[model samples]
Target: MDEQIITNELLKRYLQGKCTVAEQQLIADFLDDPNNLILLHQIMAEQTNSLWDSSADVPQHDRGQITVWQRRLHERMEEEQLIPSDKTKPNLRKRGIIPIRQRIQWYAAAILLFVGLGALLWLWIPQGAKPSEQLVHQKNRITPGSDRAILKLADGSTISLSDAAKGSIADQGGVKVQKTAEGEIVYAAVDKRASTQSYNSINTPNGGQYRVTLPDGSRAWLNAASSLTYPVEFEKKERRVKMTGEVYFEIAKITNENKERVPFFVETDKQVIQVLGTTFNVNAYADEPYDCTTLLEGSVRLVAAHSGKSELLKPGQQALVGNNMLLSEADIQQNLAWINGYFIFRREDLGGILRKIARWYDVTVECPPELSTMKFTGKVSRSQSLSAVTEMIASINKVKLEIKERRIIVKK
Candidate 1:
């Protein structure tokens, strides 16, 4: 067997959340190998992780933790560049008229200057003009979730709240369903329902968002390209609902026949969030890479379908489920701000934030590689244009942002 095969297997196991004490030590030992050291860049480049847009800024404490990791990544990359190499070649400029390092610095500066200038400069001087050379990898800003989506019912009824009148849709069980003209889909129970077999659902588009209230007095907010399959009224024993995309819930307190709190379940593609009477967010968008459950108020438990691993989350905690599972506590307030209509990024990674921004803005993004590793902390309104928010963020981050039509590209 090839030595690299053993290394790759170890990485696979690690990513699968199957690493034991012995296996972790094995991976550490293999990483010390020269061959593995060379492959570290490849591994980091290809590995993928999961995230959810709360549309809120990261809390101060969480931002600090992320900043430490960001600095560590930067330092590691800097050190890697210092590794001794025997592949150095002589300079081809001016027939060895100057030192190689000096010539390189001079040429690099000239090339950078030309690119930083404009096409007008190109009209004058075509030579020594490096075509599309990059300087630093600039991290980008994350846009908030969009307010665009269509609502489809199990009965084949479609509600386009993306650009429609926000007012009473129907009066079922004496419930007043209205839109606030702000595109917030809401339900108010003016009359009580003794019989509990009715259901309703809200869905979001690739660049949309919405909010609604259940007949049982509970509230929910749906994120971009997401939907919630919940009954108008819950039942005894347990309350269950299926979710696609993302939705934040404020479950109503239920004193059952036994006077015990019956658990509420948010069912998704791969896992289920079991709750009794609490507020939390479930982000399980089909368009996203993975599913996430972020808890805000009260206690909740996440049961992973694939690994059979169960996680209990406290208020202000989050669980990310995908090819692997990662659980961490976050700021509940900042993570669930979507219900209010804005995005708050607290020292978030460029690529990480952009993924959410891309989904919300319904736009494609291409940025400097360095930008992907950098982090930003800020706030922007999702109510305005995506470009408007991007400009605000780019200005603070010392990056140049351009919007050619709907596409957003960042330059340094």
Candidate 2:
């Protein structure tokens, strides 16, 4: 088959499953040559470059249809003995193709060729750096975040929790603030002053996470670049806290003097979530399109901060507050993934995933606007180093993740 004869439109149709059986067979045969893979990379790279220049020309292929087509391609290639087996990986490497660390699944392999990778440009080792030196350099540059946060006292004093000893850090009003061995802050009230007007706030930096047990016994798990401000003691009409960014809350059922359960309220810029002994995750990142609250237990009432529109969310529901409020079924595990130290993506876009990578890894991510539509599905450990996480994402999706200093560039 002549390489010049394959048009970008034809390849797009084949990938989109609009090609006839005969045409599909032709593409299959055309892909049989090991060297042809490199040629395809060149064609796709040119197409991608064109897409960048005029994004209006980008194809709108359905992901479900693409998945079906990719699975068929995998099955056909396997039946024809085209996909290299474990023993043939070394041979592929000898032919100037990087050896597959493991057999990549159908969807990943398909996207690697079409949606990502331009001749394995970013994966190749630099000319001067040895493999061992590159490994060492990556380790030193892209390390994981540690226990770190800033605690602001009501008296205008600030404490660096990361540097503070594991003991009583301070006393707010009569509430003794104790930093536990596990890096969690717990509040113990020594005296109950009915009109105590003391408040404290803890803010976590990018690449930082922390937990706090409020004086009312509610626990808040703060994600990277988040902050929580609350009174030192539960007073007044309700237990309220102001929050920014993402946090998971396990509310404690607190009873007032009348033996009635006091409602716990989480106030963000977009909405107010009211609960009584419920577990929920709230993501109100300033950059995200909506303020999302996912209920995992009990119930929650979401009140839009501006319009005051209210919605009641059941245990397995989520409320998204944006220009308009929406309620839908929730994915509890995905909502709480950060609290459990993992990044979970279920058909999430590459841009959103990279935004999270930027936060937790404490790095800036520059993703081409054209790659916004690329989606991924997987779960990665939060404990992994930035290099390991990026490598895993690249391997699973076959995309090139370029890390330079504290900045990451995603290239297709």
Please provide, for model 2 over 98-216, each residue's C-alpha lDDT reduced to its tens digit, 9 standing for 90 to 100. 54424332222334453221111122211222111111124465767767899999889999999999999997666799999998999998887523577899999999988999988
* TM-score per candidate, chains pooled: 0.57, 0.67
Worst 10 residues of 2 by lDDT: 117-126
Q: What is the lDDT, from 0 to 100, of the residue 201 in candidate 1?
A: 74
Q: What is the lDDT of candidate 1?
A: 0.58
**Segments of candidate 1 deviating more than 4 angstroms:** 1-149, 162-167, 171-199, 286-290, 367-371, 396-400
lDDT of 2 at 224: 94
Model 2 TM-score on a 0 to 1 scale: 0.67
Q: Provide the lDDT at 146 for model 1.
A: 50
Candidate 1 accuracy as TM-score: 0.57
Write down the lDDT of every candidate, Cα atoms only.
0.58, 0.70
Query: Which candidate achieves the best lDDT against the true structure?
Result: 2
User: Candidate 1, 400: how far from true, in Å?
Assistant: 4.2
